[model samples]
Target chain A: MQHKPIHIIIVDDHPMVIEGLKTLLSDDKRVLIKNQFMNGTDTLTYLEHNSADIVLLDVNLPDINGVEMVPKILNIRANIGVIGLSTYSEPSIINQMIKKGVKGYLLKNVTGEELVNAITQVHQGDFYFGSEVQKILADSVTQESNDQPKLTRREKHILTLIAEGKTTNNIAEELFISPLTVETHRRNLMQKLEVPNAASLIKVAVEKHLI
Target chain B: MQHKPIHIIIVDDHPMVIEGLKTLLSDDKRVLIKNQFMNGTDTLTYLEHNSADIVLLDVNLPDINGVEMVPKILNIRANIGVIGLSTYSEPSIINQMIKKGVKGYLLKNVTGEELVNAITQVHQGDFYFGSEVQKILADSVTQESNDQPKLTRREKHILTLIAEGKTTNNIAEELFISPLTVETHRRNLMQKLEVPNAASLIKVAVEKHLI
Candidate 1:
């Protein structure tokens, strides 16, 4: 029985680097290199005719940027995942890629094994961050986490429901509580958050990953 | 004196599409087509040796989804802008692109004039969203904005400083207010957001974009 192959395309401008990647990745039968490109334009063109499981793209392209191609590529095929391969460990780039919905990011200096692992992780729909990238993300999280507020159980429950897009009346009904109680909880939340409306509440929930 | 031509590359699998794009863009003496490729691999490879000011990429490529390519291209060139060309308008894709720092997105069916405008805007470090895209983004903003919290001005200012990593003492010092007042503001913010700790407070702040 043949196993399903993970089709991949390596997009970079260097022939030597491409050849090295191919050689390093050659032994894995499950990973097949579908095609290669030297720039963003050609990759976009090829994508019109073909599809792959993953794309390993360098950020610095000769004619265009790799980061900018993400949306256009996804518009063509929503299912394909991209793993940003880069030489620099810039925080801005890492943050941008995460926001862009990249499944994984690997430094160009990573070992072949790590690269393969990153591709597989992304294919499985899990997020993967390089070691350096993780530190960058953690720094932000740490600074922010220090001051996090504690939630009362009732408030926590209310916030959860709110994040789930529940109406106040619905929450009251579900909790077998008075509408006034729900209102009080909401009021408390507003005072604590100093926000003015439900939209901001939801926004905060999403940002803090409270939901 | 003649202005320097903006270097460009077109990457798509369709020869006809490449030709059409070239013809349309070439009319401007300020634009130059450095090369064209049918795949991401070659485009990436060529970028190693050459450089361009912009890359006009199709959202769909036969090898990989275009959305996935944005960060990959950006990793290679920090300065080169990208204009994503797509046939559809997807909220997630657009949101993803924005996070990845794409300069602009253009539907494939857009007018040549619009395309020209998109490139120019992206090259100048401004953002361009096609008309339909603008509506989608506006809708998201509207939806998000509706959740605005009803915090007092003092609460809002305190929340802002808190989100920016200010301590109660620091905030009080900056505002020329008592630390007790800052704590009161913070406590009020927590009650409003319904989060119990400083960590959750910042989280809510980020979610609501209150900061």
Candidate 2:
């Protein structure tokens, strides 16, 4: 019996990582490395006209943020599966990538077998989060959920967008509001939560189950 | 003439990771897996009775913290090389592990070639940090060296201990101070840095090049 190899596009900022991924998948005939890109811009450009079964997208790219890149890739190719990759696994980043529509998430240290398994599962229209990634996400859920203060509906929406890795301009543009208004909402959220920055705000939100 | 293979022990809570590592290195004749342990205690006990050329230890273990495991391993066998492993790459953890005498550090996603190279390099008494780990450490160094207030030498020492993933009790014991004094120092450090937790304190300290 013959099976079509799952086509994969590897996107990472580091040349060695791309090379390593290629080497890891070289012997596996089940998944084919159809193309590779060093940054997000080239990957987006490639996906505009071409398509692949799965995209191994790095979370940190020189050009575009990996979380934001998910939607852009999906906007162009609705059916394509994006599997997030990164050296460090921040629960917020992984959770944000998933909320934004990644079919799978993997740490950069993924074994070849796990890589193939993730690609195969994602290509079959299922989710595949690597074991470590699963543990991180699970840990996030088990954190002591605290009783929290309430926010206005608009503020909550903005907080979600913020947690989703949106820039002020991106959120404003998406919500059809002014950037200044978005900034004000952000400030209010911080003040209400008593956090210093967006990262901490998201951390608090995750802890409070507010977002 | 054939050289003797390096004896290696695998320590990770994940059984799959150990199996995958074995499979990855199965074809390579230069190294040998002498034994494997799913927790740090057994690995430590094994080290007491027997020593291997290298120990591939996971950063997270069910029984012990990975970063703290370094000094303990070296205490038992000063000549044996210890290579730190983790699913995600945390710069502080990597830096702390290096400070405590880990010859090499690798993310779990290491390929057979890189893993073997790291082991062989460390076995030869050289340092080997995976490319991604190297990038992360580099980023940590390049963080803005902030112009900040000065800390007393004692405060700085406690800060270093904290960044090395030490607990209040551990710091107190090591520094010959009461745990309450350690708590006071930690609180003062947090107040000076205007951060709420040890993690954030470390982040600011890293950014300021204070640690």
Candidates in order, TM-scores: namely 0.35, 0.57
Q: Which candidate should be chosen as best, given TM-score against the real structure?
A: 2
Instruction: Give the alpha carbon lDDT tens digit for every residue of A1-211 in model 2.
Output: 8799989999875544666677778889998999999788899899988999999998888789998999999999999999998866677778789889999999866787898899999999999999999998888779722336689999999987775556889899999999999999999998888766665566566555576
Predicted candidate 1 versus true structure: per-residue lDDT over A1-211, tens digit per residue: 9969899998876543565567667778879999998899899888988989998887777788766877767888888898887755665566666667678887755666777788788888887877867886788666543223556889878987775556779889999999889999988876665566654564555544345
Instruction: Please list the residue runs of candidate 2 whose C-alpha ends up more than 4 Å from where it truly belongs after superposition.
Output: A1-3, A10-50, A61-63, A85-91, A106-121, A126-189, A192-211, B12-29, B33-39, B45-50, B61-63, B85-95, B105-118, B126-187, B190-211
A-chain TM-score per prediction? 0.65, 0.72
What candidate 1 gets wrong by more than 4 Å, as runs, is A143-211, B1-211
- Which 10 consecutive positions of candidate 2 chain B have the poorest summed lDDT? B143-152
lDDT of 2 at B2: 98
Which structure among the candidates has the greatest lDDT? 2
Per-residue lDDT for B49-73 in model 1, tens only? Answer: 7888898887667676676677778
How far does residue B11 in candidate 1 sit from its true spot (Å)?
Answer: 34
Q: After superposition, how far is residue B110 of candidate 1 from its true place, in Å?
A: 38
